[model samples]
Target chain A: MPEPLLARSALRAHVAPEIAAPAPGVVLRERTDLTLASVAAFKGREAELADAVRSAYGIELPTTPTRVAAGEVAFVWAGPGKWLATATGPVDFSTLPAAVADQSDGRSVLSVSGERARETLATLIAIDLHPRAFTSGDAALTHAASISVHLWQTDDAPTYEIAVFRSYAATLWRWLVHAGQSRGIDAKL
Target chain B: MRIACPHCGLRGVDEFAYFGDASVTRPAADAAETAFADYVYLRDNPAGAHRELWSHALGCQSWLVVTRDTRSHAIETVEAARDVALARTSEAQS
Candidate 1:
């Protein structure tokens, strides 16, 4: 039998000791526990796909750029008739009527929170992150430093989760660290 | 410049890629040579109120048809290309 492969973090080499220690203003952590999948509805079968997602995940499929959560499962609208489904535990995507592709290893999620989290993110994201404009549960598929990213707000603490392609994770980490430098960052992976 | 993406809301123009004129349509397989030449080589560089194609490369990744005034750089309207194509297909069928 072949040897089992071990999973390694995308930021393993880039996350230095100086960046990992706890800081006061901004807290950054890599979320490695969640399982991710890209779900795309078939043309002309959007309603069927939505129904299947609702029954299987106990959450409504978001038609707009928003995030909807039910229990441990959360769905963030990626594009028209497309969503990025994330769950902390195992999820059966087979029953869904749409096309589902595993993205657990294809992407990396980084969570940023704290008193100056919004300020730190402001330097990188071009869109408005103000509470009134982008409140909790809002999601956006935009770019940061010209690299494509899927960003979403989770709670009132103003915690934001950014998902980027696996290869760009290190570059994103560097950008986040630089952006949060003035505010101070507590980076942990 | 900013574009109001139908799916992702307003975003910077840098997030999108200009795909040129949206008025051009593919000719039939058995179309005349002149028709094919016009479709491939001929393009009208209108000075005002031009319909163009743009893809939201960084956001949502949706292709959009934007009607803009070339002289003033004012975007009159933006619609998803899929909807526009679907409408054309239905119109042709009808």
Candidate 2:
């Protein structure tokens, strides 16, 4: 294999030196290796696009406003006639009238988990973080710390991924750390 | 205020960004000047239920047509704007 290129975290020097498990119930970590892409079906091509995605990725393209994941391949309902797809490795979509673009660099993801994770998020956002309402596999574009974030619950143990603009990574990290302090956060850098 | 996003369920008002008057549709360019002007600039400020467009900015980012009671701030119906627009376009073409 060819030598791998060096990739730097959006949080760079900020999260580098050490990965600390700061407090108690909350575990904070920055997930930088995932790949993300914006996928949109062109005008008059919705059905064909869905079929193509199903064939290409071995997963259905969600038409309804919901997030669905099959293993490491996940589709996030972004807007009308559009979805954002994320996967663990390289992402490619070969279909007519379908637009796919790399969004991995544009977005920075922060993962938070543990018992009080829901409570910690609730303190920052005005949305209802009730388990019954925002369940596992559910995703939404919402504001936290006054910044636009795509928040999703990956599993029932109250694990969440907050994806924000790479430019706002430091700010979001600070906000998360502060909010999670009360719940005792174990920050992994 | 809370708006029920059809796909995402009930969420706080802060997650949504509002656009006015989903009830309005632009007139054909060649139509009467006054009609075009009305469609572009005039909007109703109703005290009761109103139909308006709201984007779920913090989630899904989908445009929704929300039927809400202006006085009580209660949402009566919420739907994906794409469906509504597609229906209207097809109906007009048909």
Candidate 3:
């Protein structure tokens, strides 16, 4: 008989669900319930794959480095031939024509919200996070805290969802926590 | 240096992984030893505009061909490397 299995979040050992009002303007929280998957179009099958995704999920798999949402599922273009999809609950892509792989356990997600969130992100990412530049629903794969991470502007309050490999999550979280110290942080870990 | 990625806009150099000289062409498999050696070991250290392959490792993950002035670090143009290479192949065949 197979041994019993247990599942744990990437931040299980790093963060706990609690709010720390470190300063007056920022709130950091672990995005614990995200479900992620990497979807890539098979070679020479781009259009067909996209049609299948749209028909199945009711949203276009973005072609450029942008983000789009329909209901609970959010899609971010990962690159030319690929996209990453995220939802608050389990998302099954088995019916789509694209190659889909589970990334829910492969990444750690964090959300930094509040009025000062953009300013805080600027200290780590070089991209123009200004609302004029990276407005709501915008996403990009970028370097932050010296690690490759995906960042998305989820709301007008300038909330951001940062997704990084599980291995780099701890280091990135530490950097973010430190960066927010000056402005004070409302951490909901 | 900052590169204006076609898809993701201007981004820091740290987000990219550079591989020098996109202009380099691999010698044919049956080419002479000298030709293969040159392909493997030789590269031009151009003083002016140079084209190189840069993979946006952190964002978009698109491989781009960036043409920039080395002396001033001014980027001239950026395009998808796959598109450029495919165009080149078709151009050569034509």
Index of the highest-DockQ prediction: 1
lDDT scores of the candidates, listed in order: 0.90, 0.81, 0.84
Candidate 1 lDDT over A1-189, as tens digits, reads 999977678898766633633556888889999889999998899999888878887899999999999989999999998999999998867568889998988999999999899999989899999998898999999999998999999998879999999999999888888888888787767
RMSD of every candidate to native, in Å, equals 1.4, 3.4, 2.0
lDDT tens per residue, model 3, B10-59: 88888889988999898878999999889889999999999999998777
* Interface CA RMSD of each prediction in angstroms: 0.5, 2.7, 1.4
Error of 3 at A188 (Å): 2.6
lDDT of the structure predicted as candidate 1: 0.90
TM-score of chain B of each: 0.97, 0.92, 0.94
Every model's TM-score: 0.97, 0.84, 0.93
In the range A1-189, model 3's lDDT, one tens digit per residue, is: 999866576666875443455445878887888888888888999999878878777888787778889888888888888888888877786556888998888998989988888888889988888888888888888888778889888899878999899988878887887778777777665
Q: Model 2, which residues run further than 4 Å from truth?
A: A1-6, A15-23, A64-66, A93-97
lDDT of 2 by residue, A83-139 (tens): 778888765643435888778888888898989998988888877779877788777
Better of 2 and 3 by lDDT: 3
| lDDT of candidate 1 at residue B66, scale 0 to 100 | 98
What's the lDDT for candidate 2? Answer: 0.81
Report clash pairs, candidate 3: A16-A189, A17-A189, A22-A184, A22-A185, A23-A184, A23-A185, A141-B58, A141-B59
